[model samples]
Target: MKRWTHPQDFIALIVGVYALLSPLWTTTTSKATTTMVVLGALTAVLSVIELVRPDTLSIEGLTALMGVLFFISPWVMGFSDMRAMSWTAWAAGVITFVIGAADLRVTRSHRGTVATTL
Candidate 1:
């Protein structure tokens, strides 16, 4: 396995785990709980995949998509009134989105150089 190449992936992994376990400490509705668990797991999995295969640019895009989903989930799932949960979702979402998007940009820009050198 490739040694984790990107710091963003590590940060994403942390955010994912936090989101996954947040429901235990934070008051959350069933919908919020489910959303957190699902999105968190997906984030974690994608992060791991990226860490193992840093060249997979598509994974970064998916990670960004996950972040957007997380950001909007509180409202779409009707749990925005829960301050703790909503805030968690929004913060994690933004962090994940930014990391993913940034990584995607860096990876894409570097791709041509890598190909030309090979």
Candidate 2:
């Protein structure tokens, strides 16, 4: 019924889409838009991997990294002046990070259900 799969990954995917398209709703400088698009693309790509393969936690881990990057993009990209971009990055990044952490927790609790790599 598609009800028992990893919901965390699904949430990540949704968040990724939103982040990727965030530039459309907000008016920002070129740098901010570029940062948003790049970060969002990374999050989405990692999410797709998590869904199709569900391999080791590495994909989820990468997703988390992407989230972190997004959250800090405002500062790193030097576009903190744009409130919309900054806020969007923060929100999207936090959501993706939370999802990744939740997935990790779910897998850990599954009792060997999720495989790991060395």
Number of the top-ranking candidate, with TM-score as the measure: 1
RMSD of each: 1.5, 3.7
| Regions of model 2 farther than 4 Å from truth | 1-4, 111-118
The 10-residue segment with the lowest total lDDT in model 2: 109-118
Each candidate structure's TM-score, on Cα atoms with residue i matched to residue i, is 0.94, 0.84
Per-structure clash totals for the candidates: 0, 0
lDDT of 1 by residue, 34-117 (tens): 999999999999999999988765998999999999999999999999999999999999999999899888888788787898
What residue pairs are clashing in model 1?
none
Put down candidate 2 lDDT per residue, 1-118, tens digits, no spaces.
Answer: 1332777888888888887898898988889988888888788778777777775556767777787888888999998988888999999989988888777666566635534431
| lDDT of every predicted structure (CA atoms) | 0.93, 0.79
| Sequence-dependent TM-score of model 2 | 0.84
